[model samples]
Target chain A: MLVDPRATVADMLRARGISRRGFMKFCATTASLMALAPSMTPKVAEALQKARRTSVIWLPFQECTGCKESLTRAGGPTLENLIFDAISLDYSETLMAAAGHQAEEAMKNAIRENWGNYLLLVDGSLPVDVPEYSVIGGVSNLEMLKEVAAGAKAVVAIGTCSAFGGLPAARPNPTGARPISDVVKDKPLINVPGCPPMPIAITSVLVHYLTFGTLPELDHLNRPKSFFGQTIHDRCYRRPFYERGQFAESFDDEGAKAGWCLFKVGCKGPTTYNGCATYKWNLGASWPVESGHGCLGCSEPNFWDWQGFYNPLSTTQWGGYAQIGAAAAAGAAAGAVAALAARRKQRPVGQDVQEEGK
Target chain B: MPFEALDPRDAGRLEALTATASGAHGPDPEACESVRGRVDSGNVPLLLNEVRYALERLLDDGTTHAIDVRAIPLGPGEEDRLLDALGRGELRAEFDSLGRSEVQECAYPGVWCVTHYNEAGHVAGRFLEVTFTPALLASPPEDVRTGLERLAAELAP
Candidate 1:
């Protein structure tokens, strides 16, 4: 169904049977996710309610379509997707039924009409060296990007490919893949990268842009600091296990079975930063580690080339050994038992002090 | 008897060298006692906003929150500012768990300032909390009930 570009977001939400309470609830959640004080919820809701429909032109280049799944999974009916859907998506070749000349014309029309105001969303990497490697309509990925980006208010690099040369730019990269930042350096660029970014994470960026009329505060990687400021290890549920020097040696060992830390199995949670711990995936469903798989460090730069997915990450730089040295030598099977035993034996700290307070 | 206006040329220098340092009138500037006490704390505004939000959440949804003050960089006087802004409520407690802990309810209802000190008595951890009761003092009611039931059974036998 075609939505009018002129309608305020509030009008659209009302049309969809969404109540103010629901919208406000989502805003509160978003504000919390953004680490904003609760007072900001009203502002978030007001911005979303009254904001004009923004024109978004999504350009997919050398890539797989995994990102779409994250969008569809979490973004289907929630306010996050509703806000995203409320935006006037003038062109997305993969999503739009229009093909051939019709598709190209839609792209041109959107650019011409909303010049300097529309947002350009790019997923996948651009085949810079070999234009012929990937093309939409006889125009190379780089050529098309340069043309469309020229008229954009901001550019959002939607996946690892567009931020850091993702899988397509992996070893012996055949397509001469390059990230969006490498190509479009002038515009206000935001990198919302992951294997396929969490849908809420992606939508929050759009909401932030609409609310403030500018990109959200970004980290060193130009990704939103609210989401990417801390590594997965920092927020991981298994972090306490890691601190105590307990680790799963293999995929199905006792440590693994008991939900010990995955560091020994090459879990990239420590170095990788993403909202997998906080937001999880698949409609607040479990992420990999919860289900017994280690983190692949999918959100990081050049993660594909980081080599062994199952190999343990070197912790010499982080002083992992020195921190947990006394217990580091013990294997997970022995460590878990020993730690539990030690915890029981350790003197109860400040019991007498607590009695006084009581 | 009468006030005569000073000549313009003399007016500029009439105050004299000593007068300039001490001011033309009133007490000498240097004689005024030096200021003391914290004027403002930088972190107060941020932490106050956090407290406000936490209060709203607690009232609206019964959500509990913990604010680690140490995790946030405190300005020179911000901690004092936060303390002043928070004021003080009914609850106050101190503990030596692991090291030492001081928990106090702030001026705002349900808001608390919890500071943990290491063995050296220096603050090792500090937090602002918003909740019906401090987390450290809370124990599970269900667990307590179960233990009580078991104890009653033991006494009966």
Candidate 2:
């Protein structure tokens, strides 16, 4: 698992004994994950063939290690993990072998060596009120973020904690937690917000950066539009049940057995935007709704403080039933047109099916 | 005293509820079948038209095209209908690399259905490729070079 600093992604894959065909498969999957049309597969393959390993600096602060666990503890060695492994991860408190001053030196050296070129990834929130509340190696979270982000080409807020000041900023905030965006204003920052964002979402962002040398288009929230453009309700398999007004009343109701919508039982999918319904969790095995539970809306800002998770969305002060219905209809229509327009916009100019010289 | 406190009818209902809850991981097969029979998103016709356009492009020029089947939201059983309409051709090729891959030509010339599976045997990607022949079917140049070197060494006397 020794990766050469200068090796291209293709070179790294080949060194790992991956054949060209395997590389093609990887590109194909990457394109799909990035929501790029299948025609872009060759372009992905070509770009990856020349993509040099990027130096990534992962900083963790006031938060649980769930995001790291989600990225690394996916059921098995997925292509996403392989691509992540290809990156030159110079610093990570949990993942790196270096410790204490040695780890600090690695971080500083990585910044000095690849300054203005390296990508910065932050996973927890910053306790701005009392910086000492979340200090690492004697450096306050706020100070460390400001210092590291200055040298980064772009900063990626890896989870809801870093992106939207997740649980730490929920309610009655003790130390006044804040998202990375609040602190870092100069650099381009993209949020991949989730309780622990989808593994593919994280990898897809990395690959998008690698392939095009630019971050993917972002929504108003600065989350990748490709992965978070649509609400979970838009793509839920039980959407038909919701449309038909068939919902499970209780956990073991007949409707529950029949796989009806959990909307009445506090599913926040209608408002929560993430790729959980589409890309799914556990390598497309199942998500919360599929397991007969309501969506906790973990990806949204202040979700932890959202009215009781067991109370139906309609019961909350967010909206009434009629408003929800109207919104759903309007959102669906607009989403369709927007999706089609975006697809057309994304297509590479001039070659339809295959690029020239293919 | 505990047995007397619990009603026999309540115990039976609880057992039934437990069975129902445990099976809630996925949609019931019967309901799925019923839904599949009723739902038609009308994507097949549009996809077929797309395939026709791709074929015309391939015929007019040497350009090839690929449509990701997984990307499109086809309604229940719509994929089957589309695949059935395409109809399988004589040639079928399978490649084992990162996992399993099957490339097969459809009834229409230059129309192909390509499927790639991961090591876990789950379908990772599915594409409808419009080309004279899939590029994957060809031996990569690097592999050919490696083969040549190995063969030459084997033949050396």
What do the candidate models score in CA lDDT, each in turn? 0.68, 0.78
Q: For model 2, how does the per-residue alpha-carbon lDDT over A79-165 read when each residue is reduced to its tens digit? A: 666777668899999999989999999999999999999999999998989899988988898989989999999999999999988
The CA-based lDDT of model 2 is what? 0.78
True contacts kept of each: 0.00, 0.21
Best by lDDT: 2
Clashing pairs in 1: B41-B77, B41-B78, B42-B78, B86-B107
- The regions of model 1 sitting more than 4 angstroms off are A1-4, A32-37, A315-358, B1-157
Candidate 2, superposed: residue stretches over 4 Å from native: A315-319, A322-358, B1-65, B72-91, B104-113, B119-122, B130-132, B149-157
| Top candidate when judged by DockQ against the true structure | 2
Instruction: Write candidate 1's Cα lDDT for A244-267 as tens digits.
Output: 677767654557546677777878
RMSD of 2: 9.4
lDDT for position B150 in model 1:
85
Distance (Å) between predicted and true CA of A260, model 2? 3.1
